[model samples]
Target: MTLRTSAVQESWGPTAVWSCAHAQGEHVKFFVLGSVGVSHGGPVLTGGPPQQQATLAVLVLRAGHVVPLHELTAAVWGESAPGSAVMILRTYVWRLRKLLEGGEPGKTGAQILESANDGYRLAVPRGSVDAVRAEELAAKATRAHAAGELEVCAEALAEAGSLWRGEPLAGVPGPFAESQRSRLAELRLHLLEERLGVDLLRGRHERAVPELTALIREEPLRERPYGLLMRALFAAGRQGDALAVFGRAREVLADELGLDPGPDLRLLHARILSGDPALLPAAASPAPGRGGGLPAPLPAAPSGSAPTSPAAHGAATAGGPARGGAPAGLDGFPAASAG
Candidate 1:
């Protein structure tokens, strides 16, 4: 229940193994059950060569799924990877396992770094990594926002944002992680925009101005942020300053993306021009905390609809075209159902 410690029970063969992740202050333990209940305590990792740590961190960050071996190699070596890349990767995994398990190299570590058909997978529990927790919080925040729980949305958004200690998978780079990090950054900005919208709706415009101003600097091309900035400025009784923000956003968007403002933004600009306050929705006012966390359960399998798992989709891949035949970056997105 507490983020620091989790209770895990596993049924194996004819035996059930239960282990508790007990944390003593800053100390951490990873418990597992297979042949027997094993506890990995006393510094899951220690300081070492930067590259080795980066490699292990990347794997840990993406635990519970395979990371393409080629992707992990590229992440560590960039373009200068030697011809014995696979051998070197094996060595790194060997060393990292020794460090993590605090036991003989081949046995404890081999179980963790599982050999999948495509590459390798680190089978750690969810919430074991901060990255997983942050992703979950962001998903929850997104759901709360969509459900019209503005105050709860803001709190969850802030909690999700607070989880990022720095750049995601910091000091690690690979095509998959790069794409994932970009998506997370975009999600963060969207969440921030929603949070600011909630604050502005609550007439906390004065308090929101500085944050919105800083956000505009970071996301100059994002129209929603600019709109919020304008609203904040206007509400703070600085009409001229607010209009100036809109003008700057217009110039930046035209110069950069070579496109006109979107409909929502153009409408906001027009309202600002005509001094028509009716364009602002009355629902902008922040409702006091309906709750402070993730949203309720999403609608389940709409009536009699059958749900598909990722493993099933991966199995379906065998009947589909070869992997490289499709466009890149489309694998993760769900396909449109023909039916």
Candidate 2:
């Protein structure tokens, strides 16, 4: 059966919903983001053996592409495949097709799970897979953030963050799943950092404080989150608390990594100590003209007045090389540098 689209007339206009082009399409849905499983348009399908599920996990991780038989066997069996591994692999594929397509063996079309020249391919629509959709949203968030559209950036990031139900590939065991679990988790953390950066730029310091605090507690050794927490505290008029946070972060880094806090952190500490007027939140400056160099650094705020937040003042300037021979790493990532 082929996948079919149906047009329905509505009061506003005509709308379309995809119907089972295949007789059984209405009953089948496949998923692999949080776990490897199938749903017949309702509850998750079960009763398939673990090995079959592992095979399916590998396929889903590499969805919309070809996964060779040998690679599949290694992922499922690791280093201990039996002589009948190929036949057994074929069996698992057949079982998955049965679950995913609701069709008999050898009858499922190339539209869903197809036997390619050298491997198997699962053909599904873009964004049908949750992980792919999350990545797409993250890309959108990155673009919005770059354009200084903080509201759009936050909304896209929130939607992307919502896609994770739990540990990705949870309960699905294999080399492929194991590796991908860590990779996806790291990507999620990066997205979170990006979101926090946008929040700081948008003057959401009070809102960012709790989230950055929790992130620092969870990952004390990571430098970026601590930087964010410090910035948030300072922006919220908690200068003492911000300095204390730097002290604690310094302790964590020195204790764990046997290294001092980086230049960015040191510069931020100096600014907080002298109460630099650049730490207050303000509207971002307009983008530089085409081929024009970065905007000049914001002038220091008047004494006793709210200073522009370091993120806002430096965000545009940070895109260019550090002025006056500052470290290269301090340019892009937010951290107060010498003024």
Top-scoring candidate (lDDT): 2
Q: Which model scores highest in TM-score?
A: 2
lDDT, candidate 1, 114-230, per-residue tens: 678767786656444444444555556555555656577567657655544345444444443444454445545544655676676556888999998898787676566677778
Displacement of residue 306 (Cα, Å) in model 1 is 22
Looking at model 2, which ten-residue stretch has the lowest summed lDDT?
Answer: 305-314
At residue 165, give the lDDT of candidate 2.
56
Local distance difference test values of all predictions, in order = 0.51, 0.60
**What is the C-alpha lDDT profile of model 2 across 1-339, one tens digit per residue?**
232433422100122222234333344444554655665444556527777877877766566678889988888787888899899989888877767764222345445788987789876543344556566666676566556566897877776666565666677766656666655655566556667866776778899999988887776766777777787888788999999998998888777768788777788789778776566564332335633334334232112111121111111112111122332211135422211
Q: TM-score per candidate, in order?
A: 0.63, 0.72
Flag clash pairs in model 1: 201-284
Error of 1 at 238 (Å): 3.2
Q: For each candidate, how many residue pairs have backbone atoms clashing (under 3 Å)?
A: 1, 10
